[model samples]
Target: MQETERLAEVRERIARAARVARRDLADVTLIAVSKTHAAETIVPLIEAGQRVFGENRVQEAEAKWPALAERYEDLQLHLVGQLQSNKAEAAVRLFDAIHSVDRPSLVDALARAIDREGRSPTLFVQVNIGDEPQKGGCAVAALPGLLDQARGAGLTIAGLMCVPPAGVEAAPYFALLAKLARDQGVPLLSMGMSDDFETAVTLGATHVRVGSALFGARA
Candidate 1:
């Protein structure tokens, strides 16, 4: 399908899913995960009226988005991958929100970066909901301490984020993340992706990151 048609279809799916959950459509933010796609590729989605986009790396986003943003100034870029402390400043400069804050050290780095750059992007603490060591999020047991450190450092966390184990049912993980977010007093739940976003929305996902479904297969 054409990108425009796909955009409309995805929006409709989101609306339908939200309605079934009795949640307002406006409460859910559809983030087109544009990682690895070039500016020429993303421009069509922008023209299709997609404003919020996700990038997995700070360097790749730096290479592509500035040129695109010159033409599409209203775009909101989100950093949705594991962030390195050394790149904190660059990530702070490039993204409107960062979703992979999983440790106290990162909290310190981001706090300093935000202070130095004078820009406070929305922050989401990623929880390793499955306790997967290869993953970049904190363990569920360690979340409270991490959230406290981030807050004490003056980072107003937007909510919690989680990437469920691949090839497994994601609803349970999404529900766990939502309950933890409520327990922590944060409002946003950045769960869900291209495959299970509808389920995530039904479970209280305020933001869904969709890629191949909207942008086609990545190069």
Candidate 2:
């Protein structure tokens, strides 16, 4: 399928999902994950009114930012992949929202970078809802305290983020994230992806990150 067609299909799917969940499509922002894809592939989506784009690597985002941001001044860049502390400065300068903040050290690094760069991006604390040690997220048990610390460090705590275990139903994990967000009094729930985002929406995800479903399989 063509990229424009794929983008439309993905937008339609998100609208349908929102309708099924009884939400206005506008409430559910579709973040097109642009990791590994080049500027050529993403520009078409931008032309089609896809304002929000996600990138995983700081270096890749840096390479793409100068060119893209120059053309689309209102573009909202999101760091949806796991971020390293060393790349915090680049991240703060480029990304408008960060999805993977698993470690407190990285959070502090982000705070310093944001201060140095004079940027304020919404921050999400990544929680390993499935408790997979291999994954880069804080355990569910540690969320409240970590959130408190993040708030104290002058970061605007937007909400919680998580990627559930593959092959298992994602709704429970989504529910857990939503409840945790509510418990913390945070409003946004950044769960869901291309495959199981509808489930995530039903469970109260305010924002859904979808790439493959939108742009077709990434090369």
Instruction: Point out where model 2 deviates above 4 Å.
Output: none
Model 1 TM-score (2 dp): 0.98
For each candidate, C-alpha RMSD in Å?
Answer: 0.7, 1.1
lDDT of 1 by residue, 1-219 (tens): 887788898999999999999999999999999998888888888998899999999999999999888887799999999899999999999999999999888899999999999999999999999998888899999999998888898989998999999999999999999999999999999999989999999999999999989988989
Q: For model 1, state the Cα shift of residue 129 in Å.
A: 0.8
**63-83, model 2: which lDDT tens digit per residue?**
987789988879999899899
Each prediction's TM-score against the native?
0.98, 0.96
Residue pairs of candidate 1 with colliding backbone atoms: none
What lDDT does each candidate get?
0.93, 0.87
Candidate 1 segments whose C-alpha is farther than 4 A from its true place:
none
- Highest TM-score among the candidates is held by which one? 1
Worst 10 residues of 2 by lDDT: 9-18
Per-residue error (Å), model 1, residue 85? 0.3
